[model samples]
Target: MKFLIDNWYLVLTAVISGGLLLWTSLRGKSAGVTTTEAVRLLNREKGVLIDVSEPEEFAQGHAVGARNVPLKLLSTGEPVKQLPTNKALPLVLMCKTGARAGRAAGMLRQQGYTQVVAVAGGLAAWREASLPVEKSAA
Candidate 1:
């Protein structure tokens, strides 16, 4: 205990760092939906896939039939007006990364969307899985 007492500051730092790492690992495991799982939900649950990409990026390429409601617009409450489905439909949000989609999903949930989900790996995972993408006609 002499060594720990002499290096109390170092010991405290190590304990705090270890606890933070443990908490982070546990927290990181529960976020987002995998591509296959998302597809299964889409097919079985009739989930509405909402692509939260900008207009230009969306037009370049996006999941076939995905409704493009840019994150900026969605955040501003404009996309809800344009959403084709009612609030009862299951909403799955997707973006280049899961970050924006997660935010969108949270917003949707706050807006009384009970079945809102965020696509785990986002569009990058869909492309990696060899899924079809639709490009807007130039």
Candidate 2:
């Protein structure tokens, strides 16, 4: 007790950090892949990236070669309209932020997509990493 009292700041800091980690985990905000990792997956494993943003946001800007599949359509089992039929193929989901992509990843898994993951920071992270982005101009 004496040691704790002397180092109260350290103990409080440790407790707060542990609590934050626990809260994030309980909230289902677990980590995902980085832009570099996504690129590696794409180049080495032929992974497909699906943007879960609306068509308008997709047209605004997205990872180069990403397909727009909107979250609502995915929730309805639409498979992004042009998704490949192979369940074994890897599918990477992305959004403006990582939140929607996380939800879409769960839906894809429920739809029997064996390999699905969300980009850690979504398109914003991709852009921050200096990766190429494309637009539809529509």
Estimate TM-scores for all models: 0.76, 0.78
Regions of model 2 farther than 4 Å from truth: 1-29, 78-80
For candidate 2, which ten residues in a row score worst on lDDT? 25-34
How far residue 12's Cα lies from its native spot in candidate 1, in Å, is 12
- Measured with C-alpha atoms, the lDDT of residue 76 in candidate 1 is 73
| Residue pairs that clash (backbone atoms under 3 angstroms), model 1 | 33-120
Q: Please give the TM-score that candidate 1 achieves against the real structure.
A: 0.76
Candidate topping lDDT: 2
Per-residue CA lDDT of model 1 for 3-94, tens digit only, reads: 99999999999999999999997766546778888888789988888899888888888898799888888777544665655788778788
Candidate 2, residue 87: Cα displacement in angstroms equals: 0.8
